[model samples]
Target: MSADVIADFWPYVMIVVAGWLATDIWRWLGVLAAGRMREDSELLVFVRAIATALVAGVISKLILFPSGALEATPMGLRIAAAATGFVAFLILRQQVILGVIAAEFVLIGGWLLIGA
Candidate 1:
């Protein structure tokens, strides 16, 4: 390739490499560190709790203050779907996949019911 052609691609190449390094550096360090940590360690327990809380908070924010299409749906439908999912989660012994599927089913059914 000509020097001009290589120069034209250099910025894109650098952007991709920088983005990868930015995200993967921490993941690489985590993998290295994880091997030395016990599953039931206090740090692990706290990390799990924080992760769960963050997930819950994000879901709550989505339901309570949704954007675009979700905002078009009634709040009651959203709440009902969440409640059904919560029940399914408990009934299925905290099976996350099943609970998410149940919630989606409820939300989609509600959308169809309301002619959306």
Candidate 2:
């Protein structure tokens, strides 16, 4: 390839290699270990609980102390959106994607209605 083509493509190649190195090793390890893990294992349960808690903490942080465009929205609207989403999630048989869609719809709708 020409020097210009190499220069243009080198960054993307580096990004792909870095990303794979950063995540794929752990993924491979997990795949190798999953077959040996029991569904009722304490370690698996603990890992699941920790993962759930981490997700909850992140979601709570985003809702309570948001930055960027979300920071511009009112606190009540944010709470309402979250509550509506939770209700939708329950009503929709715990579909996470539906819950997220419901939350976004409420958030955007409220923002539009309040002209904020």
Worst 10 residues of 2 by lDDT: 14-23
Best by TM-score: 2
lDDT of 1 by residue, 1-116 (tens): 99999999999888878887878997898788778789979999987898899899998989988998899899999999998998999999999998999999999999999997
Tell me the whole-model lDDT of each prediction, alpha carbons only. Answer: 0.91, 0.92
Model 1: how far is 10 from its true place, Å? 8.4
TM-score, cand. 2: 0.63
Per-residue error (Å), model 2, residue 71: 6.4
Task: Give per-model TM-scores.
Answer: 0.57, 0.63
- Residues 1-116 of candidate 2 have per-residue lDDT tens digits of 89999999998888888887778987898788777789899989987998799899998999989989899999999999999999999999999999999999999999999997
Worst 10 residues of 1 by lDDT: 14-23
> Candidate 1: lDDT of 24?
92
Clashes by residue pair, model 1: none
lDDT of model 2 at position 100: 91
